[model samples]
Target: MNLIKTAFCLIILICSSIPVWSQTTGKIVDTDRQPVEGATVVMQLPDSTYLGAAISAADGTFSLEPMADRYLLIVQHLFYQSQVVKGQTRDAGIIVLEPKEHSLAEVVVEGERPLVTVEQGKLSYDISAISKKHIVNNAYEAICKLPGVQDRSGKLSLIGAKDVTVILNGKASTLTQEQLIEMLKNTSASQVQTAEVMYNTPPEYHVRGAAINIVTAKAADNTLQSELSATYSNQYFGSYSGNVNFLLTKGKSSLNVSYNPGYSHIMTVMDLASMHQYDGQVYDITQRQKINTKGWKHNIYAEYGYQINEDNALSVGYNGALSGNGKGTIDVNGNFQNSHNDKVQDSWLHNVFARYSSGFGLDLGVDYTDYSMNDYNHLESELTGHTRQLLDYTSDQKIRKVSVYADQSHSLANDWTLKYGVRYDYTDNRNSQLFNQTEGKDNVDNSSSRLYEQIANLYAGFDKEFANGLYLSLSATGEYYSIGNYHKWSLYPQASLSYSPSEKHTFMLGVSSEKEYPTYWDMQTSTTYMNAYEEIQTIEGLRPANVYSVNANYLFLQKYMLSLFYERIDDYFTMEMYQAKDRLALVYRTQNWNYYQSFGMSANIPFSIGNWLSSQVNATVVNDRNRCDHFWDIPFDRNKWACMLSMQNHFSVGSQLGFDLDAMYRSSMISGISDTKPVFMVNVGAQWNFLKDKASLSLNCSDLFDTMRMKVKNRYAGQHIDLNMGQYSRTVSVKLVYRFGGSITKEKREVDSSRFGH
Candidate 1:
């Protein structure tokens, strides 16, 4: 309690000590009298000395703090001519910009404009610059083209950052990563205006660590738009997916809806060899397994927004996903074990949310999510000495979550801003496991458990922009967590500082602290079987991990970046295969480690050749160390150094055809007691635009050399295991997209369901 009070007091004192300054405000409009959003407004001295800058809001309004009584105001936009005005008072009034004339003839441009810039202590990338040189069909593709951004197997992360949260229009979202990615796939690339990346997030966003905010273009009133797309992919099996997105705006109301449906057939194989030492005896085990899964999934989203007035607005939305008729089969054959299993599974998730915002910087919102999953499995196994065993079981799990939040922001004197918020979350989870048949002395039993968890959070922050191109932000959060008979309180503090001396150089530094909790099912006392020789079990009395991170970044010429980072996690938990001391079984269980530490450095460089080829190269080197003194009966310490390199190239042939090639390589790494071999992968894609740029066709091939396979070896304290894992990593896919009607823009919403399932 004393620490929390001291932190808050420090922030208040710092904010109150800054001297007040006069402000400059203005509005921008195009020749058609339409509000010009996303225009750059700069306040500068007569000799071009920079003072400050602001981006025009949705209503074309802007505000900036200027130190001088007389200054020069400049407004610039991409499709318009620049405007300059001499200002002496606080108000600059409305300014109009004329449209730039364009040639109708076909011509090829030989040079590219700068696409990256530093604004308001964040890295901003112009989507228009990318769209002019690359063929991007959706927002997700455009985001992938940004520097230092990486996409691995449908998951997105920023280079040198631990975790990334994605939001839309600078608003907080409750969606999980998977759901947010799906929604971005359905959004049209033309609707994206810009994307901002923040290393140290603000308190008003209600998210910690790094974040990516995607800003979309606003639609004109009384406009309707729609887009339809279909995709087909083939790996070892075949898959099909299709989606439709629609948007409508009239007067003061807007409606957006999207639907996506997919069917997939997936197959995977694994080979394992183990040498076990138990009871002063040595035993050798070898096994090969194959699995096949087929399923149909559907995703739906709908949102409605109403403008009650210029000062107040209301919005509501629903998001859901359902899986139907999912079936799978597993077959295993080994020297000491042979098993065959059949399984059925089904799952669904639904989320609903409503929010209200006022011009006074007050926001109120509520969200609810419900999720359920059911699984049934039957297995028959033959062990050593011709012993046979049979097992059948059914499992069901359900989760319900509710959250509410209120946020307020105040524009203080000078260029300072203060924001505060409070939020509460409640979750209920229920899980049951039933056994129908068991034979040959089963090692697992039927069980049921129910868990209730609650979290309350309070946060406050202050931000200031100095006249000399320096920016600073400080924030602190107090949290109270409760589960069953356990209760705890924690404090998290974050700080960030940035300085830009000129257009050619920018520097940033950030420090943050946060906590991550274990999943619901991982904390329960449950057991599951994979084969006769292997089983999965859960432990009780698990604690959440605390993470502390520091990051520093430098950007040069808006095209190159160098970053350094260090992270430490206490009580880190992970799943590891342990040799049972009392039996001949290999158990996979989640256990907490003493600590995990990592330090890394990364660099990104982008270049172009002859206006036809653009390429980006990224490289990272990291050292990881792990220590645990009381792990089962054997204690060990491990450390390793790893390196990663990736390159992306885009080639354009005329105005309609484009080609892309991307490749990545990772050196060997160690986790727990396992050491993994190196991995390399390459992907190629081609796109063609037709029908006056309204339709596009693309072809892509991933894992061109089929080298993305994992080979792991675990050899420690007289326990040895060799595992080779492979999946349908190589795939060939084709996609077709068509757009019609007027221009469209839509917002995205997410639910808090990342830990809802097993």
Candidate 2:
């Protein structure tokens, strides 16, 4: 009976699209015969639904996908006119889009609703500090409050996407967890404009999933602005920092200069543990370790752009940061194994890039990073009753690469276009660790090392549009793989289609393949560090993981909108136990040998209440399956489920005063790290204009509920401290901003000498 049912289902699928092949198929191009990148060609059906569509590629070329129903073809681009090829299925051939200058809108909303940027039916968010309200003294402490967002240490899960990538501007910012936070700590919210959070990237973006693009103020306004800021925060200790930014622009040429001076103090407490059996009673022992740390982070950036004759332009950009770290530790008991660990780390990076634009544009640049860390460990173990100190060594290294890429766009014909480009980056690194605490004659070197291929992604794509309101696009990306001693290559493919039958209805389907490497922290060997117990314990890194993603969605309703979407993944990466095996003292040894799979659904609904409030509700559910060959020692199960529900309310009372509120609730990881239950979180912020736009007051209460807490349990026992782990915190901030340079021709930007938090 099961085989019969399966056979019937297969027969139904084979017949579902049999009639679609009878439709006409052709390529779309512009007057120059160039393919327009992301240009959408759509075909409208009788039911007011877009049944088929395509996008143009680098060469201003596009392909038409056959549909099963009759429809009207439509084509459109960023600065182009909407071309409608109104007709029956017989007319579903070539879609030619014309270029139309569309820069007249005074205010461009960067949200994924398509108010700004090209809309190929994918969601996008721009992560910028320009317009974002900076909550004094915190970054992730603020970021976690974002809707459908959560951060555990350095890992950020956006809309429940564990394999997400956080990008600044348009490229990657490879800063460590703490460094990344420190960098954000100095950036003021006033410098941000909009952040586009995109779940599915179009063919043009050669990056990872769920991108947050922070867009700063651009030259479109022709205004010059600058500001300086400083901040002080008290948690474990009082910390202070400073930042300065100078921007200048006139017509199409712009120049920017900035420097950030970060001086800070930190103190943290940790707990450790071990287990023992006495008199048939199993007990866990504990230990405590304390560290008082001091550090400094310095950064510099200079960038300039010239319009050099309309058709040709150029830009030169450079940025770099240097940091110094030092720490001191103290032991309380005679057991030195539970004593303070002393250490220091110094790191710096610099990069330069020059971009040229002409008939075909080119991007040329290079970047270098230098990093090093050294530590001193003191051991006081009862087993040996020996007190000794050992000096450990970590030889961190780095190298930069010269990269060159080009983007070419040409006008193909009426509504058809094509576009393409490629980028290359070279990298080199050398890192190792050593300990000299034992006898000089025999010291163990537990660190494994290697040096090999460092390169940028080689990618390309093609797109096409149909005047019938139908569009289709194809993209191929070459991925980069680097590990301790292994290097491999993979091809990522992407295909998408958008169809709209009427002005207010749209549908989309897409599929793709991609890969992600474990961060240094995830792949690092057991890092020799003194825990609260003062013992030299190792925190091994999780190995690199791979993924395959698929998604489908639809949008409609002239005024009321409702859409549904789903995404599935394979071989997801996370941490799990191996063989459920262990010994006393946990002489720990584990590999990055964990795997899982997951699926999720998302829905968005928007409603208006009278003329005062604009509100929207979004809900999502994700289920993950842990498929490790053996769950063994792992305490958590292979199945996890998490759901998130959010509500966004925008208030409008005249124009001087406005507010935005977002609230969220989430369930445990369906296919996540461990077993965590549900929790509630909220974020509220408001912006008020005073003195007729001369001054503004922004108030924000992030983590309003302060319910953001994460907890983990340790399995072993130590001498002095117990391993009790979790992180919970909250922040409250308010800012008063006033504008100075107006009617007067803008001069070189002047950094605001003093501000509470930059």
Candidate 1 lDDT (Cα, 0 to 1) = 0.81
For TM-score, the strongest prediction is 1
What residue runs in model 1 are displaced by over 4 Å at the alpha carbon? Answer: 1-76, 79-112, 131-136
Give one digit per residue, the lDDT tens place, for model 1 in 217-291. Answer: 765444455678998999899989898776665557877777788888888888899899889988888999998
Query: Model 1 TM-score?
Result: 0.86
Please give the RMSD to the true structure for each candidate, in Å.
11.3, 17.5
Give the number of the best model, judged by lDDT. Answer: 1
- Cα lDDT computed for each candidate against the true fold: 0.81, 0.50
TM-scores of all candidate predictions against the true structure: 0.86, 0.68
lDDT tens digits, residue span 56-78, model 2 = 43223333445554566677866
